[model samples]
Target chain A: MSVDAKERPLTPATEPFAEPLAELDRQRARALQMGGAEKLAKRKAEGTLNARERLDHLLDAGTFKESGLLARSARPEARAKTPADGKVAGFGKIDGRWVGIVSNDFTVMGASSAAINGKKMKHIKDVSTQRGMPLVFLGESTGARMPDRMGAIGRSILGQDRYEYRRMRETPWVTAQLGDCYGSSTWYACMADYVVMRKGATMAVASSRVTSLAISQPVDKEDLGGWKLHTAISGLVDVAVDTDQQALDLAKKFLSYLPSHSNQAPPTYPVPEGSDEPIKDILKLVPESRTQVYDMRRVIKTIADKDSVFELKPGFGRAVVTALARLDGRTVGFIGNNPMFKGGAVDPDGCAKVTGFLVLCDSFNIPIVMLVDVPGFLIGIEGERRGAPGKIINWMNALALCTVPKISVILRKSYGQAYLNMGGGRNSDEVALWPTADLGFMDPRTGVNVVYGIREEDDPALFKQKVEELSRDTSAWDLAVLYEAQEVLDPRDTRQYLIDMIEVHRLRMTNCVGEHLMRTWPTSFG
Target chain B: MAEVKVASEITGSVWKIVANIGDKVVEEDTLIILESMKMEIPILAPEAGTVKEIRVKEGEPISEGDVAVILEK
Candidate 1:
């Protein structure tokens, strides 16, 4: 101000535009510094990237076009302290695709929420939605600003936007928890389609200080909302990584599997080398004997494109495996039962996992491939206590509403009501079966005991006869005879069968888009 | 060294005891096999350790979270 004004001479009549433009430059420079060099260096010393630096790392070089560069606090008293109002929002490209981004600035006032920054967030959301681009939120905040949020005026300011939490699935929303995330950060993370968190980051409704005060007991931050708790118990986070850069990289990778918006098909990559190789290894991975258990994930890897399987909620529901993968370079969702845990029985948690995955695939127009090896829904008082029936029905309801191509492969066991939920019968567009597929109402031994009131040990001869009687017409050929299975495949041909069938069933008339039936499904349930 | 208690992930009866005391086992090694719903589910060691105690016998009923073996890591 001094150099420009003194050199130009302060004369309103002589130079009318000089003063205002100089002031603008000064304010812009102030905003660019972002809580001064000392605070940024402190963050650097702590091995953390500041908000702008994170944006640079996440976005393509020279692609960040900032939206609220001149924005500060709306409150006159706090104007000087709040630059960009604690949030940096802009339009950027992630892997050459346009995406709206909001990165919270923790150095300034803990990146707290206030009136002006809320407007910036709303603007980004509006433009991203209207322009048909995905939204990425790099979340790390200390929650709502205090004193500014106290009193009747604060009550009026809070929750003015009614559609803040409404997720219509118009665009793929991706979020990252890079540090302590609370309030808006946690809310957006919960509503996202894919959420990745740093290993040490914590995400909760409020900071531990307020939580401990409210509960009247000391609380450990990690225990309250850590990576293990969410990934293993809560199922809120899709993946947890070791560093901030890893979280951002995962966010980019997740978006790679989805479209920029629900109206378009996901981008495809070139088919990887060796994709045409036979999956003869699948024969050895799945045991022919129905009673034995094997790792279903190995079967999934053998079927999908090489190194393209990205698993989601891997720790929460041990019985089911949901992942995003590519077949012949096109995106598809895999819902497979894992016999390694709980005998591949769908529990309440597993039901919720499948339901959410179905919603995502349907909303984004990705085809689904279900690898059926489920014994049945786990039955017990514990399952009943967790509302297992409602969750199972919810999964069925979402699957029925889906309009995209669904292909089912009955690898081994597909029994009881779980058969319908796992893409059996009219539930899927195409059904393939291996010769080893075991289709029945229940396990033969258990059914015989329930009907005849005799253990296999007591009447071995009768048990064998009864088991054979019950197992009649339940083989892969039997299903094929009834025209239920489109094809009876050799275990080796499973991968090529899925690829050709997906191409045949691709929604050509609709431009490879689905009906978006489950667009309004709730984002969080586990 | 740490003492890790290996627990059953499901409620089942012990069908077979494959590991004995003083035997060294690696992660995912089958220490005991449990049978439920006509499926033999192996209770695997979560980490590499020496088996210090086998607490459940074959055909004994065990509930979920019931520790079946104590491993010295």
Candidate 2:
């Protein structure tokens, strides 16, 4: 009736507890336990999750196998004062795939990276690289421990092994910005394949407190390292969520789309039964009235596999929406403008959003689906002040650099510079338009004013009559006659069209080279 | 005791500003707007002042947070 020892799951050996070395191990365990408890309480008070809690939420239940549990600082005084040097380094399984994790506990002397902690982190990274395991960093730190890093010892620990930061060709890495992530935390997050952040979390080269003092200004955390600043302005962080749990969930979700390592194929998940719906229903999702706005998000959700969309920067850029979603269980990045905002116009912020999203998708090998209903880039002096011109050019540049399979669906008003920016024509692998699409340089009414030089107020009745005449020339049929779009089809067929086109592009050998852009994009903003 | 004011920058509406005249205004305190694009580009006070004049109203079309009046501090 006794179970064979070799067949059982490994357990801590009792003999090790009885040996003289047991005292040293117990002391190490006690220090770590106490440090963990205090850190957990502080983190809870701050409305943040401790490193271990974050890791637990990130990995599958009961799957973590820790390493370097006994490593301590080499600094004589600091060694006795810190336990595990405030870091928990180990390996764990996320969705049955192995991943390396290192979580920093700020409660232990501010979670500063001392000599031993750095060594532990470097070792974990090295092992993950060699084994081709995905590495995850649950980063929240106060930078390098000043005491340990101020002298000769500091000089020795200053530079990481070049190979440590030199991203391995195959291993995927992810980082979570859980709290105040400065210095090393920021560095690791920048290096990740996917970086997720809590809404109020701060990730910057230096903490706001430090920067404020240095610059002599009252620094607000959001202003200093807010999601808006990073996601919209710098494109440093990938996605920002509202809660700690959501950040953890995003990390898990992002990893699901990527291979455990570059050399292997991405793991496939079971297609949820009955998830597929008729692609024709996508037509009804968009409103018939060109002036009446509908939520692009609803259309996106309907066309994509049920509940597969994971939106990024949902708040910062109200005009354009970027999301990572799955269609038929295959990962793709979706970029579209919400007609509800500025009539789906590409404003400065919207342009920035699309540029960042395109770069991310290109870098990550995620094919793109551009849902176009753009009136055009925002015009007028306000747009110019906000650098609209620069952002538009930037978006176009990013679009041109993209090598992934890009499919453009002109849901409606594909006008002006935005038409080219939204992967129209040569910018896309396949371009299709809904029956109602109006692909043009500008709205017909405005086009008449610019072309005819007739002021609307000068003779309202006459100008109105001319505008109506001009409107007759712009329509989906007009663009089709010129072959601006490959084909104009019924709205309901959009999903199938995209699915078919993506499949065709995916099969091409050229697609592979473009997918590697994610691997080579600079990890941080200079 | 008072002086005429002009718009600092040209753009859109007065999104918001941190200062008003007769409110112990200090130099470099954001006076008002021109909210272009999605950003709130601020127009700071040129000099510290006392209640002088008000030009732009919230939600009103403002090329800049135009100064209607001046400070006598």
Writing each residue's lDDT as its tens digit, candidate 2 over B1-73 gives 5653534443556666555666667764656644543334455554577646666677777643355336566
Error of 1 at A206 (Å): 1.7
**What digit string (tens of lDDT, one per residue) describes model 1 on residues A156-249?**
8999999888889999999999899999999999999999999888999998889999999999999999988898789899889988888888
Range of the 10 consecutive residues with the lowest summed lDDT in candidate 2 chain B: B33-42
- lDDT (CA) per prediction: 0.90, 0.74
| Tens-digit per-residue lDDT, A1-526, candidate 2 | 0122234444455755455555555565555563656657876897887766777788888788777766777877766657777888888899888898998877777778777888889988888888988899988888878867897867888885766567634577888888888888998887876788888889888888899999999899898888868875666777788888998888888788776665454554556655557455665667676755667888888778777787876655667888888777778889988865545666677777777677667655678999998878767777798788887887888888887789998888878778899888799887888888876678766776798888888888989888788777577787778787788878877777777888888835653435454455454421
Interface RMSD list for the candidates: 0.9, 10.2
What's the alpha carbon RMSD for model 1?
A: 3.7
Over B1-73, each residue of candidate 1 has an lDDT whose tens digit, in order, gives 8999999878999999999999999988999989976888888887799999999999999998899999999
Candidate 2: residue A173 Cα off by (Å)? 3.6
Q: Which stretches of candidate 2 lie over 4 Å from their true place?
A: A1-28, A34-36, A42-48, A129-131, A151-153, A160-172, A216-223, A226-243, A262-266, A273-284, A380-390, A460-473, A508-518, A523-526, B1-73
Which parts of model 1 are misplaced by more than 4 Å? Answer: A1-22, B1-6, B16-32, B44-58, B69-73
